[model samples]
Target: MNRSTVDVTFVVGYLAVAIGLLVARSNPATTYEPSIYTGTPMITWVTFAVALAIAVGMALTCRGREQALGIGLGAITVTGIVSLPVIRNYRFAGMGDALTHLGWTRDIVAGELAPHELFYPAIHSIASVFHYAGGIPIERALLFSMVITFVPFLIFVPLVVRELTGPSMAIGAAAIVSWMVLPINNIATHMGVHTNSNALFLAPVVIFAVFAYLRRRATIERLPLGLSPFSLLVVLSGIGLLLIHPQQMVNIVVLLGAISSVQYIVRRRSDDHPILDHPTMYAHTIVLGVVFGLWALSNERFRDALLILVVGLLTEDVGSGAEVDQRGSSLTEIGGSLGELFVTMFLESAIISLIVGVFVLLVWLGRTRLAPEAKSLVNYLAISMVPLTGMFVVYFVGTPTMAFRQLGFIAVLLTILAGVAISRGVGTLSNYVSRPGGTAIAALGLSICLVLGLMTVFASPMIYDPGQHVTDQKFSGYESGFEHADEDLPHAGMGYDPYRYDHGLNGVEGDGTLSGATVDSGTVDSEAFEDGDYADAYNGIDYYFIMTQYDITRELGVYQELYYSEDTLEEFERSPEANKVISNDEFRMYVVSSTE
Candidate 1:
């Protein structure tokens, strides 16, 4: 067979073996642990690691289109590894956010909530469509939408990277390695069903279009396809971004506005400015900006939320050196382990940061060789980081605006830059060594290991596994508990979300139970059992929930500092003030007698 044919066959065989093994071994966790590998079985992750290693090896080694295909295959498989558990255990994964989204989706489907009623409705709106059209459950549909949003990364990342540095084997590797910044978050940019994360995924399309215009790529000549693909994508994705999460849309608006303003200035000075190639970007940017402004004003939910944020900024000591809160540490605080804290905060993100670092250094080192469009992006990223750093400082010192979430945005842009860096690194290395074959192989091997490691960290709850996708039986216990709750007295979970989503859905007229405030699981399990001490320790609440998730956190010590042991039944059974009103193993709710 020809080399291309052999490469193609290898690629196809690898993809099938990897994906098939993953599916065959993948099953929902019988007993919930934040780590799917331990919860499901050992083989699941072994297969994943093996499959990833092979894919990454080839992605770095193979040449031309075959390599690009390898990168896409590797990326899809890694995404699948992350998403499979959520799909398998669909109902109430990621604790409350998914449930809240489900509730909103349910409302949207039932005609109880209009799409515009929420600021970010594209995900829910699309999920609703998928649920109805595909005849799937609402939860699965949302999960499906979340994974589907990631599909664009495979296309746009490659496109942007290729645009910046021409094409090379490193472009393919970038696709796989870029998953480190997927942006592999548990918060706003989480791989799970987050609306802003979806918006962030589509951001490369906007960036790619901006660069495509610099190349003066032609419009489609056929009827009904008159516009350039970038222009059309800009329009559609611009609207999609606005609907999915306007926070990202606002960034695109600013990006396009800057590009547009430059074009206008260059046009006025010179009839056809060579530097600012895209003449029409100015109008598109202005239109998007106006639409964004109108959206901010018209959406009452967003407006009120913005005002609340404004109040936080106004009340905060922004000028104060951004001191971290000196609150008392919980038993789960890692006990002042600065190294672990730093690893958790920075090490997981080091891959993406390293890529951006390399990219910045390359811009200075090879400035004359870079395309004008790439140079412009470098300048923008540098200028933007000043404000971005300041905002993060303010947020760290306790501002209501969640500045950390913007890392997802920066991560998206950085992934494209990584592509350029990887290709340049390969080229530079190739030029330096006369007999570079062994060194090249070693470098590729190291690259493959990093890709595999990043995928595991980014996708699975390895480094942090306290909170996880809830098991079916465990979720069932909550549903069953809410069904038998007392209407008058208040109830609260010991950690995380407090089962308040279900309470709100049940529309129970209970007092503090519906507020979603949570207590420490340790306080629930080990506090004094004296007449009034036990009751007051639960914070005047009537019911204390000992959840499987809290137990998992308690066991893994992921994010639960104060949460106690998993077998709370023994402890609760010994308590005099607490009565085990609800229990079926996975979940237990103790009714604290107010009379005590």
Candidate 2:
């Protein structure tokens, strides 16, 4: 077959496999099975291998530099498609954070916001829009939301890399390098962190806006109607990020602020201040701040949360009210924590990409006459890194999990830097080689990138035998327990639905109970339950649904240790007011007979 024919055949065959995997993995018939890997494991692995081979082939056989670059872009797209089914296989609903988002989506669709602590509501709103406007079911809406929030990151990373470093074979390599290196890279498929994931989708758009603003300023062009579209996008995306995830909103603000500051510093040092060099850019920043401030002030909850977060940061006690065991680690201890973090980043990222990033940093540092734009970009990245690093230190001192959330943005920045380094390093190398030699070198780079990309995708904890957040046995038991409780209980005043069991009890309502009202698990004071405060806390509730030992034990460590403790379970069993209404291996429901 001709080269074109081969390419066409490969594309078609890959699509077929992708579609088949989706069908096989999402098949409802086998969803209730005990095994998480329902699809043939061998077939899944083989499909991934084939996709990687095709990506490498495309990169190696491309006729020109652009075509070869397309291979890198294609690898990202292909990896996303091929990895989705593998991640979603035998797991329709994600665990923990994903389950919480799913509950929020259901509440939004039902036109009733649950009277629970409000988190980033934009994700739920987006999913609700999908469900109501598109006439899709909650499951599909949730799935679509996951895809929309995640897939953009894949596209955005490549765009940022290509824009930062002029297009070369290294652009694709850099893209893969970024994907492999990011610690939170698995967020694309993990599906639980709806807010963070959604915020990330807009991160690239913001980066692109910055890129455009810089390019426009360089040419001394006027900000016309054409610029308004991207500016509008930046404004809207900023607002959306603010509503969805506070950390990401802060990241965007910091990034934009850092860029502007760097530009100012550069201009001042050079004694050059051009007139309206970036009119639209400044306008974008002003509008973002004004609108965000107004929106936050308008909502009491948002305003309060903002104040609390700010206060927490200022006080060096981000988890002030939380019942955490905070013995305040020393600076040396904090340094140890940060040390482990850097180690993880180094170990997880592609080694070659790290080397290339070091090379680029060294080369940039050694250069005396760098372009103003490049200098500003480098300075902005450096400035951005400090705040994130500090946030990690603060979180480590206050709350460890909060530090983990901060890793997403840190990973992105590191990935972009690495991509720049890889692109520059490869571009320099290619300059001295013959045409064939360059092509061969590019092919070898592409091959290494493909292998790394594949490892990143398939080896992610989300894809490769992930934790038992959701299983057929667990979900089925949870659903059955809820059904039994609904039938046995008289009122709708149910107590805390621990581990977000409300996703199973969607249409059915017994009492006026809101989901997740009281915290029955986690690092909270379990002493209350042992001291007979449980009955008083859940006084008005008619029924309490609790996850069984099996299901609870199979959950993430924090949740497992919190809820499945022998003392907690013993307290529940011994409570005279709490009569067992329904019991199963996965969950148990008790009737609050005294309250009823």
Candidate 3:
């Protein structure tokens, strides 16, 4: 197939993906328990397969009729996969954080909650606007805001590439990188409606828009209103970024600051550093920093959080959040968990990094052949690696936001480098292979590796855990279960994962820790399940809540702790001392029958 034929195939494949999403929506009574992974029809993955093939075709194609539509293939693929749980469940997307965010957005829409009270309120505010004004549901509206956040990234990343490489393969490469799920690096940056994620999607646009303004500052100033299109984008996207998540804006500012400072140093050394000739924008960096500092100072939550973190850093354990002694597990158990964790990390990050790393090497080899702007970009990325590693270390050692978003910033840097490499690589394909068909075959071959690798990050893991999505039924089970319980007394559940039970409890269990007792041994004895002697130490264990998450957790051995299952429940029931207190379709609550 030639360029035109491949472009047409790209359009057809994308259409199939769209149709697949609609067709794959879960039945209303879908039981998310046993496995949402297996529940997905094979057709869904096939649609993805088709998408990958066509994306490669698009990457290798020249000018074509579906250029615009095809350029967004990557973004569409990302937004589509992210939307699956939301559309299928017809509810929310993320596990616990998303639930809280949706609730926040709802309150904002109802005018019961003001945006200023929250640390990062841009997403809630935007979702509220869509919900209240556009008459969309807060859940749908919030996710729509998140998934649609891709539009700016879709538009600007290629434009940013164009600024350096001047069009062609980079446009397609930029879209393909979107599919790479680079910035959505870890659970920290969830592939759903989220504040940090909003920043993730907007960072490329904001940074490039700033660069665009820098390149045309003189020309922009001469405009009648002194605001060009790119200037408007900087203002709008920058403010949106500021309001959404200041931490990420801080990260972006640092990157731009680094590049601008590098640009200044290069200009001082002139011809000696032509590769570092990217335009400087000290004013832009300073303004962004000042506005961020002001917001940080004014926002009590952010201020207090930072202050506490700093004080804790100085006075207490440098990384108290990573305490293993407190996990109530033996050193061996902890070591095993750490090993398993490394495996997950390797699969989640290392696979993509290997691919990007190869491309980055290609970029360096072809550095002299690159355009000046492209050379500057390559230099910026190459130089930025050392500092970005330091930044990652600081964040990785510092906070326990549970989102590990710092890594995503580093991925953004790599994604850009990889985009440049792909642009150059594709144009040079004729040297080694034929034009469109051979190129498409090679691209598809590469894309297959990407799709398989990205699935590890984007989709629910096939084995370790079930879906993280909090379907309406699960939400109801939690709401009604907790409501029916005695809040006056303490209780425990099988799975006390920070994410698993919290969304169900709807923040009633702050941080989602178990309330009952000192039974941190993966399995704690209930008053009935244990003898009077062993159970006497922690008599506060009144009720035991057993749910499907517990069943699954025990089944898969997904947690370092949280070992309870049907066998345990059967043992509890067999005890003459056990009393069945509350039972629901999704949850079971029991206490000592002999006691009050």
Clashes of each: 1, 7, 1
Residue-level lDDT of model 1, residues 295-326, one tens digit each, is 87888767775666666667756522343332
Q: Could you tell me every candidate's TM-score relative to the true structure? A: 0.84, 0.70, 0.82
Q: What TM-score quantifies how close candidate 1 is to the native fold?
A: 0.84
Ten-residue stretch with the least lDDT total in model 2: 517-526
Off by over 4 Å in 3: 2-11, 26-29, 33-36, 134-137, 217-232, 271-279, 307-367, 400-403, 426-442, 497-546, 550-562, 576-578, 591-596
Scored by lDDT, model 1 comes in at 0.60
Candidate 3: minimum summed lDDT over ten consecutive residues — where? Answer: 515-524
Candidate 2 vs candidate 3: the TM-score winner is 3
Model 2 residue 541 distance off true place after TM-score fit, in angstroms: 14
Off by over 4 Å in 2: 1-23, 26-40, 56-91, 114-119, 178-190, 217-229, 271-280, 297-346, 350-353, 356-360, 367-379, 427-499, 503-596
Ranking the candidates on TM-score from highest down gives 1, 3, 2
Q: Which stretches of candidate 1 lie over 4 Å from their true place?
A: 1-5, 8-26, 86-90, 217-229, 261-274, 317-336, 361-368, 372-401, 434-465, 503-532, 539-541, 544-546, 555-569
The candidate that wins on TM-score is 1
Where is the poorest 10-residue window by lDDT in model 1?
513-522
- The residue pairs that clash in candidate 2, if any, are 98-192, 491-510, 491-511, 492-510, 492-511, 492-512, 493-511
